[model samples]
Target: MEPLMDRVLREWRGKRVAITIGSEHSFTGILEDFDGEVLLLRNVVDVVGNRGKAMIVALEDVSWIMLLE
Candidate 1:
């Protein structure tokens, strides 16, 4: 199977995505870019609490992705 990043890269652009990171934090945003080591996400909203706005995340920090329709 292709790597997780490859799978993410294939379908993430311009789409709304939910990302799980660490153990309790999650982010919902417009998929922006991933440059090997980091993921640049736009229009981000925190799922846990009211932490509105943009967010940039390191790839290693992500656990999984839930693609939004």
Candidate 2:
């Protein structure tokens, strides 16, 4: 079985994504890079050009990820 994140990384890399961690915090950013341990979210934005800093999230900490339009 393919890992879900792998599918996301292959199909959605460099695209905006929203990651909801543990049903608490929700992060929206461009899925720039990721590996075994951490996923890199770049050029994070909220409401059109918020352009917040990038965030590094541990793969273990991520609950699920969703693609954004």
Candidate 3:
């Protein structure tokens, strides 16, 4: 299997992905770009419905990633 980050980088583009951070925050969005260390996400919205048009999150901060079909 590919490294998780590499797999994430390869398979996530233009797809909806769910990211879990810490213990309480999770967001779903279209994967935009990753510059090796940070991820750019678009059309993001939290589980509770707070919308984020775009977001940049540090790669190290992510706990899990789920690719959506």
Report the lDDT tens digits of candidate 1 across residue range 1-69.
878777767677778898889867888888877777887778888875665567788889899877896
| lDDT tens per residue, model 3, 1-69 | 668777767777989999988757999999998877888889999999999899999888899888886
TM-score: model 3 vs. ground truth: 0.86
- The most accurate candidate by TM-score is 3
The per-model lDDT (C-alpha) reads: 0.80, 0.82, 0.87
* Span of 10 residues, lowest total lDDT, candidate 3: 1-10
Worst 10 residues of 1 by lDDT: 47-56
Cα lDDT of model 2 by residue, 1-67, tens digit? 9897687687898888998767787879999889989899987764444667898989899998888
Ranking by TM-score: 3, 1, 2
**lDDT for position 39 in model 2:** 91
Backbone clash total, candidate 2: 0
Off by over 4 Å in 2: 1-4, 45-51
Task: List clashing residue pairs in candidate 2.
Answer: none
Clashing pairs for model 3 are none
